[model samples]
Structures are given as structure tokens and as C-alpha cells.
Target: MSTSKGSSSRTGSQIPAIGGLDLLKAEINSKHTDCLKLIATNTEGNPSVVRSYISELDNSSFILTWESANPSLNGQIVFDFKKPLSTKAEILNHISGLADSAITDLKSDTKNSVRLEASKQRYCRYRLFNVPGSAVTWFMFAFAYYAKTSTNPISPVSAVLSVASREFFAELFKYAFYFRIFEGIVVFFICLYISSAFPKEISESDVIKWAFSSVLTGIFSSGAIIKLARNLVVSKAKSKKIL
Candidate 1:
């Protein structure tokens, strides 16, 4: 399969108003400490301090984000309403309170305390999981899963080929190639098992005959089928990219 690079252009907006908005909503419902330092880029004025959350008013339909770029602007007051404040002032007050509460909690917790250390560990592990680093790690994980399984241990090469075909072919053609390879492997093992199971009756001649037939009729047939399917895939991918 061919990979293509697409071009991207940057705009005037520093941080998008909705960047990482989904994560913010999730943090509100879950009891977790998520401290994110975002560097804002804008055309004018100081960068805004945005606090995102999914309160009651929006029904979580639209992402609710609060910003504190200018404290001296106006309406620097506290909030009293609790049923998911909708008005700008109410939401800003709620964010301020939330920030103050978070700060208070941080101060109460000792810097080198067990709770703080454990939290740091947990966050670091979670960060590692969330990072988009390498496909090798995921491939290794899949290999491990297959190795430990008792039945249907997936062949990594076959799995890779199957996925590549799937990306190119329709459902019917994809599955046909997948099953053909599967069948070829199964027939080989079955033949070996049968000959071994009947040690005295199954002779060298029978074993040779079975092996020869399996490759000629089974594995060879599968290879030809896959080759044709792969050619078709290449044609389609080329056409799509051209258009």
C-alpha cells in the first residue's frame, strides 16, 4: 500500500477554543487531577487561561470552556447558582471556584507525601499509554497475545497480509483470501497430525504424497488467489489516488 502526505496551513488562532475539549468533559465527571499547561497563540492580547468542563447547562451538547485572559476586564465576581450555570459570568465564577478548590487541595497535600508520589506514578503511566509513539509496541502486544493463546495462534505475517488486503479489497474478496491462507495452514497441520497419529500405517511414501499434494493443490492455489487479489487492490488504490 502507498502512503501519501497531505499539506496543512496554520491560522491566526493560537489555541483552538475546542482543543482537548472532550478530555475536559471527561475530567469533570471522573475524580482525577488533570493539570494541563497550554500555550496559547493569538493575534492580539495576552494568551487566555482556559478551563474546560462539561457542566449542567449545555447538557454536554456543546463543549463548555471558560477563559481568564483578562482579570481586569470586568465582572470579576463569584458564582452561587449550581444547576450547571449557562450565563458567561456564572460559568466563569464556577471555573474560578474550581481553580481555587484545586489550589487549596494541592496546598494541603504534602509535596513528598505518599499520595502525591502515587498520583505522579499513575499519571506518568497513563501518559505513556496515551502517547502515540510506535506501532512496534502494539505489534509486540498482539504477538504476545497470540503466543499465550491455546488455539488459533495468529501468524503475525499472515495477519499483516490479511490487513493489507482488507484495506484494498471488498469484503467478499478479502475474506476469501483470508480463509484460503487459513485453510492452507490448517491442511498442512492436519496432514502431519494424521500421519503421526497412525505411526505404523502411515509410511514415508504416504507422507511424501500428502506433502506434495498439499503444496501443489492447497498452498499453491492460495498463493495464486492472493496474488490476483493483490493486483486488483493495487489497481484500485492507484485509481483512487489519481482521482
Candidate 2:
């Protein structure tokens, strides 16, 4: 659209003023990919059109507007670093909630479906620090080490995999148990394979040394030892629950 301007009477000439407004709201559509929220916005370009999660907007007029017009912005530098104001109650509530989570997270594991939320699900499995799973992992680890012979002996790997996987699936699908078990199994097996399998054949005494050094490895690998110690100390104070 082009506008042609003509001269008017010099003394009584009036110039025309033209203006338009564009308001847009960004929303998430796909539950899988649209992870970012429209916390805020600024005057920007129209190149950020990767995925459209445009949900409902408050303005009824814009709600029915053409979808093609609400283009996304790209390479936009939006800085609202000026800390937003918070009330005293809000501040106190935030602090109290953080404290509650810190204390309860050590003792509990709640089911959370918020994928976009950055969370510490491992804290949910804080209760099952060790014990049955650890024992199974240790046995499976040793077995996998021994079974890596000329023959394909995956007995230990298979057995422990099934147990850990089953427990992991059965327990609200929280794979912390599986993660710990699998990590334990893999660490020892990797150690065993590296020392004995590679670089010719190793001496029996050397094998024993590597196996023993794993004492520290096991303690640090899955925090089983540390959690166990904490459990004992905290349990003595009161009947603590780690589930």
C-alpha cells in the first residue's frame, strides 16, 4: 500500500497521522518440544518461528485473529534484569517452602509429571540409598567381570538387568534405583575389563589390587555409603522415612 500526499492550502493545511498496534502471545502446543514459557516479551523480529505453542490469549479480538500473523521472534535480546518486586509474605513463603522441601526431600519421593520443571528426582529415591539393590549390583558386577571369558557369559548382566529394571518399573517408574544399580554394575565391570581384558594378560595379584581399590569407588560412585551413614545418624534422632 502506497500513500500519496498532496499539498493543501498553506494557512489551513492539516497533516494525516497513521498508526497501528500489534499484540502477540506466545504459547506452547506440543507437550514434547515446546518447553519454554512466555514469561515476558519485548518488541522483536519475526524469525523465531520454530514451533507454535500459542494457547489462549486474554484479548478476544486477537484470539480469533489470523494464526499466520502471530509470528515468533528470533535472536531477540530481552533483558528484564531489574529484579521484580516481591512482597514480604511472598519472600517468607518462598524461604519456608525451600526449607520444607529440603527436609522432606531426604525422606520422601513424590510423583511429579512436570517435564519442563527442573527438579531433583534423585532426592525422591533418597530413601533407597543402598541395601538389596546394592547387594544385587555388587554380585552382578562380579559376575559380569568373571563371565567376560572367551565364551559369551552374560549371566550376571542379564540377571541384574532384569531385577533392576523390574524394580525400577514397578516403583512409580522412578529410575533412580535403576540408575544406581546400573551405574554400580557398569563401574566395576569397566574396571575389571580394562585391567584384565586389555593390554595382554594381567597378573592375578594386579587383578586383586584393582578389585580392592574399588572400595573407594563403590563408596563414591552411588553415594550408598554416605547415605547409609546419614541414615544411621538421622534415624537415631527420630524415626526417619526414606521412601
Candidate 3:
């Protein structure tokens, strides 16, 4: 779903939609934001913006994001256009309106309010779900590290706090691994869930036991399975600097 636009692009460009488990086209109507994308990116003297396709939340929605060394050039614009805007002026104005709307709605304590709010919107689920999961994994790692030391007995809390910073970071290092393997793992889990839910002679508990036990064989590894797709890594804005 790379950016494709214009009168020509829109003609060839279709309303690609997902219904049930199949990719299909929706009813042909005037509401097409794909046209807006073509007009802006192909237009001359355009402000460089990264268009990210995030269709999980909304089919018509995509995130218009920008990054600059100049702190003031940042904006977060999520547009799900109900009707097509024809001209370059219309598209640009629409983007401006959306950015202002996002900023106005966003409530933040930081001076860098827009960026902070934008990130919070995009990654709130990650913080809510992933951070706690990472904490548990790191606790296990901390336990392993403490177990090898025969000199003294250490509390679980002490071990976790000692490795607290590395706790989050260690999980981050596996981003590349997770991105590549996400799809396969997801399909595997769906199959497992189905198997557990409906069984003939075998019980649901047996299915669970067999599935997890095979994880040692790397066939059913339970790891990061979120983030269905990712942009290319090399020279990409998100990967340019690793902290």
C-alpha cells in the first residue's frame, strides 16, 4: 500500500478493502482519499511527508507524518476523508486542517505537545500491553541471572530493579526479528486457538499442552506478534538512529 495517486493513479487505483478474510473492492463512490495522496506527493515544491498506511483502525485512514531537524516542522495528521478533494490546494488545506484539529484535541504537559500527543496516540496500546509483558520477561531474566550467583540470596524485586533499564531495551533489540516473523506467528496462533476451541477426541487442554511444548522446538514460539507489517529498515527515519 505504498502511496499511489492522481487522476491516472485514481483510475487505475482502486478502493481496496478487506471484508471477512478476503481483499475486495467496496462500492464505487466519490469518497476516495487515494486521490488526495496522488495530488500532494506528485505536486511540485511539496513538503516532504511520510504517508503511513494504517488500515487496522479505519479503512480510509492513513497517517501523514513528517520529520525534520528543525523542531517546528513536525506534525501529526491522520486523515480519513469522506469525500475526494480534487486539487493540490484542496489536499494541502485538508492536511493543514487535520493537523490543527489533532493539535487542538491533543492534551499534553510537554512543550513538544504535538509530537508527544501523536506518539501517545500511536503507541498507547504498546505501553499499556507490551511494557507489562516486557517487565515479566525481564523478571525471568533477572531471576536467571541471580540464580547463577551462589554467594548470596537476592529478592526478586532487587533483581528486576537492577536490570530495569536493560529490561525494556533488551526487548527492543528484537524488533527486526519480530517484524520478519510476525505474520507466520499470528497465523500459527489462530490455528492453535481454533484447534483448542473445537476438538473431537482430544480435549482443549491437550491442545494447549502440545502447542506450548512444541515451543522448545521453535515451532510455536510465543514472542512479539503485534505490528503486522513494518517499513523498510535501512536509511528509514525510524531506524536511522538506534538508542
Candidate 4:
């Protein structure tokens, strides 16, 4: 009787789940505008003049059109997904690759131009990508403040060492940090040395005050300094006919 009961039981077929391709397509479609903005940034083109549209999409491939005010910067890029994208990283990498390729093409076209202004603009655009944004600059200022204030209250050497340590830490963050840190270290030490040169005993407050003032000065003047540095480099390049 038990064997007969087991044989009488029925099994139902399982339904298949929905394909991921549709969801991936939806995600890409939703982010079309953001992707276009990223492309403009990467290409150093004006986002206000950049136009983009997703022309086609299917399970395996998609087509996109990006146009800019400059005709040389307009193009259609196709992305072929060898497999269904299961993660956001896959989608981002594809978009980033497209942007990088477009920028590379633009650079290649302008690399041999003899115009100085055009060459300088291209060079500066490239440098801008490598430079840290304003947020990081402010972070460095905060680091300097903490380093200076937390050191031995009576030791001028401690203040100097604190600044050097701060710059060294900055170097570990990225090469872009190098420029700001170098400028900061120079300002900090020059001010400290000048304060020490006064014919009086340097108090702890004096060291802290000098360091704080120098950091503030550096922060306020950094933009102009960077601009001047860029101009000087460009001028040198022009003189050598390298630009």
C-alpha cells in the first residue's frame, strides 16, 4: 500500500525565471544622461554643448550616439556585451572604456598641431585630470592644523617635524597630493624659520601661530600659485617650441 501511494504522487514542472538582460538594459537606459556627462568630462568637452542618445539596445549589444559642438568630438560608439552584465562594475567599465577611447582619439588628432594656445589648452586639460579637487586641498589644510597643534607645546622642532610628517602622509595618498604638499611644506618651514630668526625666545604659541597663519596663507594663495605655475610651464614650452 505504501509503494502504491508513492507511485500515485505527481510532480509539477518548475517555471523559468525572467532573463537579466531586460533589467540590465533598463539600468543602462536610466543612466543615459549621467553617462553622457561623464563622457563630456573625460573628453574635456563642454557638457552644455554635448548631446547624446541611446540609439539601439538588445540582449547582446547596444549603440550610442554622442555629439558635441565641436564636430571632431562627435561619434557613435557601439558596446557588445559578450555576456549578460550581472554587476554594476561591468556596466561602468564599458562606459569608462568608451569615454577613454574617445579622449584618446581627440588627443591623437591634436597632438601634432602647431598652435600654441591650442596645445597649451590640451596640455592643461590633461593636467587637470591629474589634479586633486578643492575638497582634497581643504583636507590638507585641516591635516596641517591638527599636526601643528598636537605637537610638543615647547618644541619648535616638533612643529617642523609635524609639517614634514603631514607632507609625507600626503605623498602616500596620490601623486596629485605631491604638488599641494610640496607647496605647504615650503611655506610652513619658511615661516617657522623666519619666526625663529627674531631676537627673542620662540614660545610654543609662536610656533603654532606661525604654522596656522602660513597654512591659511597657502590655502588662500594656492589657486593663484597653481595658475602661475601652469602659465610658467606653458611659457617655457612655447619658448622651446615644444608646444
Highest lDDT among the candidates is held by which one?
4
* Pairs in clash, predicted candidate 4: none
Candidates in order, TM-scores: namely 0.24, 0.18, 0.23, 0.24
In order, the Cα lDDT scores of the candidates are 0.36, 0.31, 0.34, 0.45
Query: Which residue pairs come into collision in candidate 3?
Result: 5-38
Better of 1 and 2 by lDDT: 1
Please write out the lDDT profile of model 2 over residues 145-195, one tens digit for every residue: 343221444665567545653223223222343465455556556645743
Q: Candidate 1: what lDDT?
A: 0.36
lDDT of 3 by residue, 152-239 (tens): 5457545754665333433443443343245335544754564444221222344445444333322222243112112222223454
Native-referenced Cα lDDT, model 2: 0.31
Better of 1 and 3 by TM-score: 1
For candidate 3, give the lDDT.
Answer: 0.34
Predicted candidate 1 versus true structure: per-residue lDDT over 1-243, tens digit per residue: 111111212222222223223333353334322321111111112245443223322311222223454544211111223353222233334444444454454443312222232233211011112133224323433443333232453476457545654334333443554554565467556646744542222334444554454344435544544555566568668989999
